[model samples]
Target: MPAPSSTASAFLPVVPRLRSLRNSITLAANPIPVLDTYLNTYGDTIVVYLGGIRRTVLTRDPGLVQHMLQKNHRNYPKSDLSHGVARYLGHGLLTSEGSYWLRQRRLIQPGFHRQRIAGLVALMQTEINDCLEPLERQLAKQGGFVEVAVHALMITTAFRIIARSVFSNSLAERQLHRMAELLTAIQAFYVRTVRQPYLRPWQHARGQFRRHDQLAAELRDIVRGYIRQRKEASGPVPDDLLQMLLDARYEDNGEPMTEEQVLDEAAILLVAGHETSANALSWMWYLLAQHPEVVTKLRTEITQVLGDRPATFADLPGLGYSLQVIQETMRLYPPAWILDRVAQEDDTYNGLALPKGTLISGYLYGIHHSAKLWDEPEAFRPERFGPDQVRQQVPYAYIPFGGGPRLCIGNQFALTEMQLVLLEMLRRFDVEWVEQPAIDLMPLITLRPRQEIKVRFRRHKA
Candidate 1:
């Protein structure tokens, strides 16, 4: 993909099974600190037993990560750790592989092009303003400042943006809430099963798997109903993601995707599109509240670009600082903090041997926060993304959206959404830090704050 950042050492370290077993509970509770401890004790790349059962090679080495994700991606497909979600989310882009994934990728990639995303700007802004109205009312009633649980607020805003972008007005408010609830429940349970494999037998005895499967079915049914409604409508199809999927034709054969295929991809789009942005936005507020200087700088940029107006897609490019803030937030707290891939066949990187079927956990969080890679890994600084500064950084060392051929399809959409949210919120309100205990990381299917993060929003005064 890019030049190897550094040479990977041939010597590999392994954490003993007994130690891993002993630390299983601690790892399940919060793996970031524990994993960091291991990497510190051992080296960048080490073999460890996940839950003390599954043998896995976990590494934060950027060179190896690029090798697996780009240089030889075909030789590394998503392992069962990732595909496990397919059992609940269906064989969408996030879960599917081989010719099917490639075909679907080619078919759907155009839908997220820069121009297509620009088309959805108005749709995104509409939803964002709607989401902000209630908070605005709250501020008016409370005399200018309102304390909010930023994570919950971000979740609602993000879901509405993605849901409306995809389905338009096809889904009612009640159904929208229900779909969000079901997806959350299924993902929570899925992460539990993966983290605590020892509890699976008991989980099975308790019908947890069956229950989540039912939730999955219910989620699909809700989307299916709306899809069928659109198919039966006589009028012209609305300009939304669902219609885009319906209208896409495969190149080899001019056939459109099947109903099931549409459902799977749409479901995938909903999940992938919303979750990452929501988490990143939540963490962005967390950082901004504490770093008011950064917020002040943001307000300056916002004022220079669009004084007395909300941002449109055309206005985003001028708001480079907003984008840098988002890029920095993701660097510190990446939503898809870690990614999994398995060696399709025997392979070598630098000098380490990876046999067929060997599981490799690309510790993206570790890579992002490594002191060797970043000047101040823990500090929040958006200036690192300035044009000149960015060019000098090592490649793959800052992959919040990942690297290589199979990079996140919604990367542009996500960046645009986050930038819009930051600019809009700061344009209207002054984000102030509220007194609370320090936030802890909750590494679920996505990285989340363990405790609620509260921030105060004061209406801006010129």
Candidate 2:
């Protein structure tokens, strides 16, 4: 990695630095804000030195992003940073590489096909209604405030949806809650390990790593138990992800997946399945709350399209404005805000040379907020996503779900789920923000709102 540029050195005083041993621990504890500060001051792209490792951040140029993610992907492979995460996730699609990743990707790609996802839209609607019914009753009677983090609620809902879609009875509240807790613990540990790699050796002795391992084991056991029960039963195969995976056979070998592979893939699906969607929903709600006109317009569109009925798969296409709202929200606060890759071999982009093993972090936040690419980049405007308007933007200027061969496979599923949930919630209730609360970016495995998003939902009169 190259040394910090003269510009970086010039801004050293403004950058937050760890002062003491205690402060260093705290800095390692949460460097998200510090990173955001650097991006804010350095204008999209900047090099930062963190714990002796130098990282080059590219945020302003979308063509650069496209080159790295799609055009020149072979040159850059998934970074070693993902290795620690794979310990818990297993060699699932998200973590696997080389032939393993290729095989998994090909096998699972069909499960997310448009036709397959369309079949699950009804299931998603059922789950959304199940979740919203109680909230609707609460809004009708007492007009209580929804103080929970929107991201957390969205994840909870998405998890149940994905769980039910995978294992018919996997939506049990207790099971979902347990899984959520375990996933949270695992992610927390992952954040700590990534920010401070030096502490990894002591993580096990300190009980933190042990706790994560235990949670991962417990999760695997839960999945294994589900698989075992499904196998024992002589009943009909359900039309869910689990069944799909069960039916899936390797094209070359015609061999069924091993039990361990099944469990690992299922776990990966559960984690990646909910986190990104939930974060998108949470950010969408936040954006909607900020822009009342947009909210009103969305409500009007939903009312006209659904006409007091729940949103169905067919209703989705007509919810174009709602889609735009979600798109704009993702633009402003993308959940998968950063993507990283380590050079597998020496590579060059434009004219700059990248050596082997150099870690490159793509800043989606900076790319979305870059004034050079976006007009009035800081403001929330859904019109920017209008069909013609979107055409005007650069190819990679607006990649919320990422791009390229390894582009998120669940993008279509997530978009449909978010659209359905947003329409359902907005149709039944009015979400009004309490106040513009302190906005802090907690960039972990995904970008998350630091504080709880408190809002009041008033049930719409019939």
Give lDDT tens digits, candidate 1, residues 169-265.
7879999999899989988999999898999999999999999999999999999999999999997777889999999999999999999999999
Give the Cα error of residue 369 in candidate 2, in Å. 1.1
- Predicted candidate 1: what Cα RMSD to the true structure? 3.7
**Residue 376 shift from truth in candidate 2, angstroms:** 1.3
State in Å the error of residue 316, model 1.
0.5
How close is every model to the real structure, measured as TM-score? 0.97, 0.91
What is the Å distance of residue 380 in model 2 from its true position? Answer: 1.0
RMSD of each: 3.7, 3.5
Please name the candidate that would achieve the greatest TM-score relative to the true structure. 1
Tens digits of lDDT, candidate 2, 1-462: 223344312322222223223244554645555555656665555555555343444445687678878999888778877766888878788888878888989998999998989988878888888877667666557665544457667877888887887787644578778988889889888887777767878986788877788889998888888888787878677778887887789999998889888888888888888777787788787877777899888878877888888877877888899899889989988888888887788776665556676677787887887788898998999999999998898889999988999999888888899888888887777777767656676677887777767666776664
Q: Count the backbone clashes (under 3 Å) in each candidate.
A: 0, 0
* Candidate 1 vs. true structure, TM-score: 0.97
Question: Between which residue pairs do clashes occur in model 1?
Answer: none
CA displacement after TM-score superposition, residue 21 of candidate 2 (Å)? 11
Query: What ranges in model 2 sit over 4 Å off?
Result: 1-33, 36-44, 52-59, 143-149
